[model samples]
Target: MKAFFRGLVRFLLKYYWLVILLTLASAGFSYPRMIHLFKTISTDPIDLLPQDYPSVQTLLKIRDKLKPKKSFGVVLESSDAEAIQRALYDLKARFERLPEVGRALVTKPGYAFFDKHKLLYLELEDLKEIRERVRRKIQQEKLGPLYISFDDEGDKELDFQDLEDKYRKRYGGDQTGSEFYVSPNGRIYAIYVESKKPNLNMAEERAFQDEIRKTAEGVDLKSYAPDMKLYFGGSTRVMEYRALVHDL
Candidate 1:
């Protein structure tokens, strides 16, 4: 063991300079490659998806046709549906004005769908005038299962209770609720937002999220509906959505 240690000490004394020179030369040779590797690295999870996967293929195709859209889901809380709806309308307008936002949908399919489907999501008195208009149209067009003709108005009952019950049974339990913009219980409102293209850079992605949150927070919910509370969700707000999509 002493002889081996003496030999090792003699070898190191002879080769220590050579070893140091080799290591410095190796580092110099690899410095550019190290820099390039870091330059190409991505923090975005979407970059990790396999190129052959169906979602990746679909995403690439979408990218070719249109810029990828980031979705933001807004949850608004208030007991006053009318005031909440009005506030949401104004909030949506404000969101649209932001350069980052592409589109904002406070109510699904707008007033046309609401006019015809009020009994599905809203209380009977929420849209009394529109309901009356829809009722008149139903009478004129003889819509629904019974298809009661205008002539049979006095003779046959035009009750929509069965239809309402069926709609509630079919859709009330779904996550978005039986209604388009409002929840079944009527205390929560949903907004679906589409944002402009996302930047692959981490700093830009952070900026995107901050812009979305700031825009939501800037809305004066108190002026329109004092009880309203705004909350943000969906892909842009939650990065985990990217992982979930990749798993799918």
Candidate 2:
């Protein structure tokens, strides 16, 4: 064992320069290819996955076919709820017109849902007010051939409490009517920004993210609501967030 150890050390000492030379030569030969590969490689880790994998193949297929949408969530803070509401609606309208924006649910989905089923969601007083308004409108119009029908057979009627409970069970969130837009305290507001394209390449995805942030920043919340503060959240929000946080 001692003799073998001595021989091994001497052998290693004698050829150390040759080993170093071979390593340098190998690295020199492969360095350009490594650089090229690095340059061509995608930043997204998903691109690193084997294309032949079943999960990857399925994801690619679904992405190409269905184009699953992604969104960025935003939070706005202000003391004035009315101003926040006005700004929020204006912002939503602007987002709808943008080419890159698929949609902006600036107003809570629950509110819209509740509004569609207002008869079931609204308070008795509110319902009475609505009936009174309808009566007044009819009287004001003074139509000669007005036909009215209160059909109950077609309507699957349920008590307001039962309907409200069902709605709460189905779509329960702070984003529901009276609670939508402004938070319960009337300080915070939420907005959701969706991308126009589901299957986005790296550049397109970055551009979509940029558009959301840019749109938010361009709004000039001060102009819309002087006290309001806006910031973005959600998947792409970190990138878009740079502008909101920095500008403020």
lDDT of each: 0.68, 0.70
lDDT of 1: 0.68
- Mind giving the per-residue lDDT tens digits that candidate 2 earns over 1-248? 99999998998899999889999999999999876763444534357688898888887887778877777777789888878888888888888788988998865566556577767856687678557656655654565336343544222222345445555566654445464555657799887878887766545666677787788888788876678898877464344434443453
- Per-residue CA lDDT of model 1 for 63-150, tens digit only, reads 7777656667788899898888787777788888888787888766556676576566765564574577567766656655565555
TM-score list, all predictions: 0.53, 0.54
Q: Point out where model 2 deviates above 4 Å.
A: 1-46, 108-173, 178-182, 234-248
Instruction: Show pairs that collide, candidate 2.
Output: none
The root-mean-square deviation over C-alpha atoms between each candidate and the true structure, in angstroms, is 10.3, 11.1
Worst 10 residues of 2 by lDDT: 151-160
Instruction: After superposing candidate 1 on the true structure, give the runs of residues whose Cα lies further than 4 Å from its correct spot.
Output: 1-46, 49-59, 62-67, 110-157, 171-180, 198-205, 241-248
Worst 10 residues of 1 by lDDT: 171-180
How far is 165's C-alpha from truth in model 1 (Å)? 1.7
